[model samples]
Target: METVIVLSRLQFAFTVMFHYIFPPLTIGWGSFSPIWKRVTTSPENRSLPPLPSSG
Candidate 1:
């Protein structure tokens, strides 16, 4: 019973830590990727048109 309780606590802690750590790491990568692309890419090669704003 004690071992089961300890294992359950460990699993819960792992889940919480994973959830806390994973998102910002991914979000940081997602956010930085565009800037990295822009830095690496030449302006002339970027051919996408600007979208019109609804506001």
Candidate 2:
């Protein structure tokens, strides 16, 4: 029973940690791509209006 509990705790911790690492990297990379594209393709973006300030 103790061994089972320990293994379950380890599995849960590993899963939680692995799950936590993925989203920020995925979202960050996903978000960066569009900005990078805009920077590369749109010369006018350099002087265009700033993005609307979000609340």
Candidate 3:
């Protein structure tokens, strides 16, 4: 019973830790995408289209 509880705690901890990693990655990518788009679409860039609106 004690072993089961320890294992359960470990599993929950691992799940929470792993789950926490993705959002920041997604947010970083989400933020970086617009910056990248802007850099690519600047008049100096002249190759890519204007950045799309978030709405």
Candidate 4:
């Protein structure tokens, strides 16, 4: 019984931590990545260096 309770609490803590941590990071990356890619891979910046977006 105690083992089950501990496992349940651990699962709950993991779920809560995952929910709290991932959403903001994913949202921020989703929003910023495209703009950063565009900036880095722009035609005007081509003379500067090769970017991942260009590849």
TM-score of each: 0.72, 0.61, 0.57, 0.72
The TM-score-based order of candidates, best leading, equals 1, 4, 2, 3
lDDT of 3 by residue, 1-55 (tens): 9999999999999999888998889999899997988798778988766666679
lDDT of 4 by residue, 1-55 (tens): 9999999999999999999999999999889877777776887876654335534
lDDT of 2 by residue, 1-55 (tens): 9999999999999999989998889999789767866775687666654444337
Local error of candidate 4 at residue 4 (angstroms): 1.2
What are the runs in model 3 whose C-alpha is more than 4 Å off?
Answer: 43-55
Relative to the true structure, candidate 3 has a C-alpha RMSD (angstroms) of 4.2
Worst 10-residue lDDT window for candidate 1 reads: 45-54
Better of 3 and 4 by TM-score: 4
**Lowest lDDT block of 10, candidate 2:** 45-54
TM-score of 3: 0.57
Which pairs of residues have clashing backbones in candidate 4? none
Q: Which stretches of candidate 4 lie over 4 Å from their true place?
A: 47-55
Model 1, residue 39: what's the lDDT? Answer: 58
Candidate scoring better on TM-score of 2 and 4: 4
